[model samples]
Target: MAIKKDMLVEKYIEALESGTIPWEKGWTTTRLHNPITGTTYTGINRIWLTFASYLKGYKDSRWFTFNEISNEKKFHPGEKWHLKKGAEGVEIKKKSIYYNEVEDKWYNSKQYYKKLATLNDVEKEIFKDECKVIGDGKGSYYIFNADEIEGIASEQIIEVDSMTVEKMQTIIENMGVGYEEVMQDKSFYSPELDAVITPPKERFKDEAAYFKTLLHELSHATGHANRLNRDLSGEPGSMSYAKEELRADIGAAFLMADFGLEFDESHVQNHLAYIQSWAEVLKNDKNVLLEAVKDAEMINDYILEMSKERQLTLTQTMEYSALDINEYHVELHGCDEGIDYTVFDNTYRSVDGGIIELNAEDTLLMNDFVEFIANERLNIDFTNYECKKADYEELMEKVETMCLLDEEYARSFNVDQMGYYVSEIFDNGEVVLDAHEDYRMFFTKDEAEMLSKELPMSHVTDNSEFVEILKSNIVNGLQTQSEVNEIYKKPDIEVLKNLKIDKPQINKTMTFGRGR
Candidate 1:
């Protein structure tokens, strides 16, 4: 059935006048957050984001885009947020599924199915559901977790466990509910003492399947007198029992959405009688759906609000983390930078700026950078906070020097006879390359070839630098290269990943150029 936008708009207007949108009388789901937009996603967007967060082990559920973080448009002027250097984003594809290729048109699912029903046999077969008609156009949103961004604090971040299963397990343990995990077939709740008992996660197919049962029981637990005060005196297969179960079914579905789990309808289909009863009841009454949804929202909200307090309690005992960490203290960085780093603490004390790995990662240095400055509050013993001006200036110099002198750099080169990028093009049409950027010239031929695929059209030269420091970083175990860095070994050229063109198999005397 086609929805008349005008008629629905009129009903919505009436709903506004009457206190609520008629269809949405009790539903306004906004579980996951998009902090950059100060809004929330709905439906599949929510699920995909949640799945990404879980898979990535991101504690903060809020996500932001590259444009929003890099540009000042989303925030107040000069107040742009920063992403940790080298942090990768999760891509969420915007679905354009209604688009049809055959006959070149777009249609809603009902319209497409209705059209297929009217078609002749050949057309019907061509327009079948198995056809790759669901469009996944190039439109996609690349987003970063709030944890990836520097100085972006979020209370929703929970750090008790590594995996979502472990996190949920930890949460359940702390929620003060009577809970037990056993090696049993059935899982259930007892309202008499507000308790839940279920098989451990290992007993189920996966966390999602286990949580499906767990959330159902927890929904029942929400009905205790101290909670939502639900009436739960229903007997087996009784009307009241079905009614309560109906509320749980809806509540489980909502909770599943909030937790980023895909609802498997097979569980419902397996219990055909339960469904038939609900169908009959729904057919006889119109208000049951709204009432169930309202109650389900309440149950979902109760569980989340209660869980958050426990999550925050756990996060407090922890500290900032990353994929890799090398700690730095500004005041203690006056000496040489290494695994054995030392800094002078004669006057002012430096705060712990969290940890950072000092590796010459070319991708992070040359690519778009998120200028992260850790501002973690430290409770160190100090004479005065105001005595940091001169100390900070000297310490910042050391921090910059140490960070710049990371151990090894980007891809290594095995083949010695390859052209490399010597000049880099900037945004304002300026080509710049420092005299001391020797690390950028040590790529192997395979690395050069791979980089050639992504570079813009530019110049390549055969001039080489054999860095003595990078001799150990050649993972390809290629032949011994002539060194020429500070040790001044023989020159070995490196190809730039940003220079567009086929990898030029050139001698030291060769220089190639390209523009497009």
Candidate 2:
């Protein structure tokens, strides 16, 4: 007996109702659209071009790209309305469509249309505007829609009641430091260990998952300050550290259970799987599930205790002061010839028409002076020092003489009390010593005659003294290098080569006694 068109439509609806629709084997029906008219058409010959256009637009948008859309139905171009056959075939108008694949007596598309027509006004609006009937045959069809359709299609209804803004603010205020602030010192902060809760940028698709991550971080914060004080001493990979991390994980789970935040079977399964893996690592034993549970329970208890205390404190009083830090600039100067110098004062005094001034304190000055001596004396390259090893102590001592001389002379002049006077000198000598203009008269009238007689012009004419100093420094550096080489002996290549050749073979066959 042959199935009627109306009976086939009824069978398709039955299949949909029974959840027996074979979506995986391709849609039993199809849909088509006219791109120029912007009108959709369904039944036997559904235009493929319309379906392709819709798919292209949906795929191109970022919002649609992330969503999962079912592709169970397909479309194909059909004959014009004038095309027809015999009486039964004539009944089959060009618009009259048949299930391209299977025509079941109880499953068809007309029943689905009737069911859709029965929906309430609001539901009907959602279905018509948001849902698409994707099918080709006159008797069978499939439906596809956005994620929003899940709410209507689902057997369960999820009521989303947002947490109050005031409540959220209170939680954050009481949550110690915010995650962003803590992250500023990233070297010390560990998101996994510290369990610092960070609010999601927006609500998540899975609300329970979002809360789980947040609660996990909150559990970590419970260990801080005066509570559990879980060895958050910033030592990476220690047993204590691992235990603390586990405590947070367990605490989060406990909190979720306490708050009545239900999870799907899949979510619960994932959690258990992760916990089981962690347990193996924590105990190094397969049968330690009970111990892990006990640890988790303890962490949960600790969290409850800490949370109560935080709430009490927040209710009593909230006092905080803002700290303001301002930076002040200090101008520094060197000698006239650009010879590096150090200033040992907090505030620099501007002189030489504001061109020269001091830098902040003795520490900076000492550092600058040390750097200058190292650059001038050691002939050490800065880049080499970064990559290669050098004796810092040796370098320090080598420049100690110059450092001491500068310090002593600056002290005698009470340079700290009355800022040192700077001057420029011009002379065609090994060292062009520039005397200050202000102090030049004093030098010429008060001490020039006596100093000139003691250290005559002939003494200034010699260049050998400076050359001798340079030669002595080079010799001392070589001697230091030789001493270092003697202490740490290099490997001997000849001895290693001889040892390799002289090794005896273990498997040589022994001769018989008769042969001997």
- For 91-187, candidate 2 gives per-residue lDDT tens digits of 1112222222211222134333333334556754654554334444234222222221222222232232333334334544554435542323121
What is residue 75's positional error in candidate 2, in angstroms?
71
TM-score of each: 0.33, 0.24
C-alpha-based local distance difference test score of model 1 = 0.48
Best by lDDT: 1
Give the runs in model 1 whose Cα sits over 4 Å from its true position.
Answer: 1-163, 269-271, 309-516
**lDDT of every model, 2 decimals:** 0.48, 0.32
Best by TM-score: 1
List model 1 lDDT by residue over 118-223, tens digit each.
Answer: 4556756767644455654446667777778876654454322112665565546545578888788778888776679887768887767877777778888777
In candidate 2, position 478 carries an lDDT of: 35
In candidate 1, the residue pairs with backbone N, CA or C atoms under 3 Å apart (3 or more residues apart, or in different chains) clash, namely 332-343, 333-343, 412-444, 413-443, 413-444, 414-444, 466-484, 483-489, 483-490, 484-489
